[model samples]
Target: MKRKSAKKTKTEKLGLIKNILLIILSFLISVALWFMGTFKDQTPVTRQLIDIPVTIVGENVLTDKNLYFNDIGDIKVNATIKGVSTAIFSVKIDEIVAVIDVSSYASGEYSVYPTLQNIGTAVTTTKIDSVDIVIEDIVTNQLDIALEVEGKPVRGYEARPDLAEYESTVSVTCKASIMEKIAGARIKVNVDGKRTAVTTTTNVELLDIDGNVINDPGIKLSVESVSVRLPISLIELN
Candidate 1:
């Protein structure tokens, strides 16, 4: 009876070990299934976005340093982004922001790398290695304003160019390279068929020393217009 009881106990122990192994295998299989379901699509994918605009910041720095930038017209670049398939595919062209800070840059051309923003967890490897940005030194000058007569007065009246009175000087602001080209500011008054003296304010034209109009969108004046008074002289007949 004792030998039989010992053999039964050994069998019971083997059964218990088998049962424990089965339970652990089942738990491991369930965990593997859950992990596969949760992260099956977590593999990263890449997408290319075109024409991503570049925004410049810290321009007040340039202003403080007396520097200016040219019209970098519609500046754009392409970026190769990588992330989870769902996240990367949902990225929009407008949502991605590329910025470059020009505060530390001096007056010259520079190849700048833009910092990407607004992309949650995605990564960017832009196609454009670096954008070429040109910084120019600003040149400001004070020029004397002159009154120019454009048209003749009525039959008995003659406009005297020398008798005109107006603002003496104005501050002209332009790029340093174009500063020497800008000579003087003049307001041309039209006195066609006018018997009375003209007194009003009008916009001035930037003229080179050779009397050619220098029109530039970047040019700014101290005032919008200059006041003028031109006295029409009556011609005397002998």
Candidate 2:
């Protein structure tokens, strides 16, 4: 009986050892497979990165020549990159930069190809959409800067326009085509809940014919800001 018990205990120990070995072997096999799949350069993969901004290189050259793009239609493009599966999966959208060199081109309409930069050596750009760029001459115009009064004075109070003091005119430099579209420039001042005269300064903004705000960085303003003085008077009702 003692011998049988000893044999049974030895068999149990051997079974435990075998189970542990099988588990270790399975784990090793899995790790080896993962490493092979991650590092191996298999077939090429394609990825489409969208809305990549097309950088306008050498734009200062145009500025020096008093030329600018009238309409840089769709300053963005979709890039198709091809590379090994690992490289494609590792690439980020920001890693790619698209640029178009307009330094050599003058004021005219032209179709140009955008060059890609910062792409990994393992990856190659398979395709990119062409861009239509219209270059126009830059022009400076003198515009009357008007004051825009926002909100109303307190009840029984009136605002007087005679006391307002500000620069009546300003110089605007922008693309000739854009200059033709601009209606005027104005500085916005708020008089909401005001019981007395108020004086303040504010920045200037350009507006289109329809009163839509024009926000173009290339448009340079001689006076970016202005000052305004508001004189309020109390009205007595009979």
Candidate 3:
């Protein structure tokens, strides 16, 4: 009877061990399935193409040592990018840009900083190779100069201070399109052969109805005074 009881107890112990092993195996298998599912459905972030508007704010002063001719006004830039779908979706257009320096350029081509960042993902980023930019020349000209005349020519020859290579006033050139409008130039001339003695300051009109001069109205010309020396022989004849 004792031996039979011992065998039964041993059988019970074996059964319990088997049950525990089975439970552990089942738990491991379930855990493995869960891991596999997660691996197969990996969520990735992908980038999207979008236009990001940027406005640059700065001061314009030619006297400033760092100021550049091309650095005036605002500049526009275009950008595009691609990344993980989730990352791209979460990315804000405003967060992906950087400022560019145009202070060194007086007049010519330029390149602004491109943006690179990972919006939603820890491993990827949307990128722009480089911003293609061009800085134009900024030019300022003085207003028209007040005209003045001096001296006189011969008696027979009259003094024509109005004869200009271009217009009388100094025309200013700015933008390329505006510069094309500059035409005509003129200068005060005194004919000594005509004969006369005179000196006086005059207000010279530098521009024409067409906004041009005889030569390049866009240029500035300086005039001191009008003078003419008339020979005694010519003066007597007059």
The root-mean-square deviation over C-alpha atoms between each candidate and the true structure, in angstroms, is 4.2, 14.1, 10.2
lDDT of 3 by residue, 81-100 (tens): 44444445667766754454
Write model 2 residue lDDT over 142-192, tens digit each, in one string.
Answer: 999887788999998977766688887889998887898899999888888
Q: Lowest-scoring 10 consecutive residues by lDDT in candidate 1?
A: 120-129
Off by over 4 Å in 3: 1-11, 30-45, 57-106, 111-113, 116-132, 143-238
Which candidate should be chosen as best, given TM-score against the real structure? Answer: 1
Candidate 2 local lDDT, residue 89: 83
Candidate 1 on 148-201: residue-level lDDT in tens?
Answer: 788789999999778888886888887786778887888888999899999888
Better-scoring candidate (lDDT), 1 or 3:
1
Per candidate, the number of residue pairs that clash is 0, 0, 52
TM-score per candidate, in order? 0.74, 0.54, 0.42
Rank the candidate models, highest TM-score first.
1, 2, 3
Among these predictions, the greatest lDDT belongs to 2
Off by over 4 Å in 1: 1-11, 24-49, 81-94, 120-128, 177-183, 208-217, 236-238
